[model samples]
Target: MSSVKERFLRYVQVETTSCEANECCPSTPGQKVLGEMLVKEMQAMGVSGARMDEHGYVYGFIPAKGKTDAPAIGLIAHMDTSDAVPGKTVPQVIEHYDGGVIRLKNGVEISGFSFLESLKGQDLIVTSGDSVLGADDKAGVAEIMTLCEKMLAPDAPDHGKICVAFTPDEEIGRGADLFDIPGFGAEFAYTVDGGALGELEYECFNAASCKVTVKGVNIHPGSAKNQMINASLVAMEFAGMLPPWERPEHTEGYEGFYHLMEMSGNEEAAELKYILRDHDIRKLDARKQMMNTACEVLNKKYGDGTVLVELRDSYRNMKEIVEQHPEILERAKAAFLANGVEPIVKAIRGGTDGAQLSFRGLPCPNLSTGGYNFHGRKELVPVQAMEKMTEVLVTLVSVK
Candidate 1:
């Protein structure tokens, strides 16, 4: 069986960054490339049904052994990495970390992370400052593949029906849009796409996307007094109306925030893109109302039709759906304890594929891949944590 570290190091070399501008299913060609490779690996491990669909989703199955009557369980992970940084990487392995500042190739330093001190004396996998480490989901992919490879061994532990899937474009929030839930053939599933070891999450933020457009009349400056209306200035005013303290950088835990993702404009027209998130549906609605109020204020100042806003919901909190079935959480916690790891249940500040999957009748929760500082150049994952998580997965499916 392949170690999780070996698999992760090999998989991160593939460029699978997802693009938000593209409306395609996979959103990028590299996702398909990774999916094809995963399917081939599954087939080589005796998974006869391994295949990649047209949408770049890879699926396979492991029939129940020693106990055929158990319910089918699904394991899921996305194949795409975040577009926050470049996807191509040069991996650096540090053997026996000394718990100090880790300087990468391009003068990027990894420090000040609260979890770094706890990871001392363990081997870590990092990358050069040129790109992200891709541990956000690829580490999850590697761990799942390692688990599947182990389950197929001759001395493998007893298990029920296991369904495995790898999705694409999760970074852009479309990972579960084209998912075939019925065809996935799982009573319930778990998305192995979280951070830190021993993390088990079932709740996530209710999410929405907001777009603000400012339309301005531009006149010749030579004869302009009150005739010119600068759209960029109006856009800045609209942004200043919102509470600056309520943002991603200032909030933590269950505190909700409105994140300004992108803004571009000139004198004639301007556009601002934002993502709204709150664990409470009512709070999310309030955030929407706040956006409307800002638009109304701007339009009142610059005449009618000057400011336009578009607010659309992306996903809801999964806590409402996951709490309906307690057995799912129990099984995961039991498996963690069985592997000598205490389970840490917390709410996810951002949404996951499982958030949408749970609302779609799958009751899926999120699991960790022993990674830290995701979606940036300083991202890293411990070798021992990955190995321990693979063992936990083994016990999770083994018949008790």
Candidate 2:
């Protein structure tokens, strides 16, 4: 059996950082590389239908060894890391953490006082201080891979048909765009992309991305009193009109907010990009309407058509879908208990591939990858947590 640490270290070294601006499916060639690698690895594990599709999605099936009548369960994980940072990672292993601050060579510190207290006494795998650790879903990938290898053994317990998919561009929120759901033939699926151990999530925020463009007329300073309209200032005004306390930095646990992701402008024109999120659908709609109202008020003050706001729905909460099939959560909880880990059921403040997959009729839920502080230089994951997650996967599949 391949250790999860070895598998994760090897996979994260592949550098599969997805691109949000890319028009293609996988978003990066590195995704294709990882997909092809997964295909080969799956085929070696005796999984049938192991193929990397034209769009760089790696999928395969492990036939039922004993009971062929059981419902087929899907195990999924993404191949790409977040585009927030580079993914050319060199993982650092800290064996037996002594409950103090861990200083990364890149001049960052993971202080024991700041959430690191929970991970004390565990072996951690972190980045080399320059890039993300890629454990966001790569840890998921390694866990799924290890579980498949175990199930393929001759003495393994009986299981239903198990389907596995390694999707690309999840970091860019396009993980499910090219997913072959019907072809996958699984009644339900689980995405191994959550943080920490024993995290089983079905609720996620209703997400939307907005682009606000402000147009202004520039004039010479001598005649700038009433003739000039500064676009940057107007953009700032529009942002300030939103509730100041409602933001990612100030809110937590079901408190939705409008996050201004990027803002750039000059006197002529300025653009502000934002991501709006709320777990409650009603509040989500209200948040969008708030954006419209802000635009309306700004336009009223500076003539019509001065502000243009574009809103696009990204994903929705999966709670309604997963609640209908309570057995999935129950089975996961049982599996976690059997593995000596208490399940932490919570609502994800952000989105996951499972959220999109659930709406696509797969009824998928998110599972933990034991990773912490993802998408930056401080990303880390516990080796023991990864091993237990793999065990949880095996237990879930083995259960009738």
Candidate 3:
């Protein structure tokens, strides 16, 4: 059996960074490359019907061996890494970590995070400080693949039908957009894409994308007195209208925030992209209202067509949907406890593919891949955590 660490190392070397600029499914060609690789790997592991769809989604199933009556369960993870950093990573494996300041290439140091102290004596896969480690969902992919390999063994315990899927463009928030729920053929599913060990989540933020465009007249500084309306300054003013403390860096838990993701412009026209998130639908609406009010306030001062705001709903909190089926959460908690890992039930401060899948009638919840500091240069995953999660999935899918 191939270890999860080995599988993860092999998978992360493929550059699968999803681009938001691309409108097509998968977002990047590298995603399709990874999907093809996963499909081949699944087929080699004796997975039935292993294939990659045109949209770069890889799907396969393992039929019940001993227990044919149990409900079919699906395991999902995204194949693409975040576009925030480069995806072509050089992973460094640290054997028996001493729990100190570990330095990487390019003067990047992994320290100050309290979670590191708990990982002492365990092996870890970290980045070389040049690119993201791609552990966000690839670690989940590796664990799921390992689970399939184990469950398909001749001496393996009895399990229900196991359906596995690897999606693309999850980093761009389109992972569940093209999902084939009915064709997936699972009563319920779990997205193995959370952070830290034993982190299980059902609730996520109600998300929306906000774009503010400022149109202003630009004139030479020598001749400009009152005629020159700086669009960049107007954009800054619009940003300032938002609560200073309400941001991703400031808030935690259920608290919502408006995160300004991108801003670019000169004097004639400026654009600011923000993501609004809140667990409460009512609060999320209020945040949208606040943005509209800000636009109105700015337009009333400048002109009618000076400021324009566009708001689009992204995903909703999955708590209401997942709570309807308590057995899902109960069964997951049991699986975690069976593996001697204490389950940490918490609301995700950010959204996941499971949030959208739950509303699509899958009742999907998020599971931990034991990776931390994702989407950046310092991302790392513990070898022990991945092994334990593989065991958890085995117990999760096995029939009594």
Against the hidden reference, what TM-scores do the models get?
0.98, 0.98, 0.99
lDDT tens digits by residue: candidate 1, 1-400 = 6788988998999999999899998999999988988998999998758999999998998999998888889999999999888999889999999999999999999999889999999999999889999998999999999999999999998889999999999888999999988888999999999889999999999999999999999888886689988899999999999999999899999999999999999889999999999999999999999999999988988999999999988999999999998998999999999999999999999989999999899999998889998999999999999999888888888888
**Span of 10 residues, lowest total lDDT, candidate 3:** 64-73
Candidate 1, which segments miss by more than 4 Å at Cα? none
Candidate 2, superposed: residue stretches over 4 Å from native: 112-114
Highest-lDDT candidate: 3
Tens-place lDDT per residue, model 3, 61-109, is 9998786899899999999999888889899999999999989978899
Better of 1 and 2 by lDDT: 1
Which lDDT values do the candidates have, in the order given?
0.92, 0.91, 0.93
lDDT for residue 250 in candidate 2, whole number 0-100: 99
Task: Tell me the number of clashing residue pairs for each predicted model.
Answer: 0, 0, 0
| Candidate 2 whole-model C-alpha lDDT, 0 to 1 | 0.91
Residue 299 lDDT (model 2): 96
Worst window of 10 by summed lDDT in candidate 1: 216-225
| Residue 99 lDDT in candidate 3 | 98
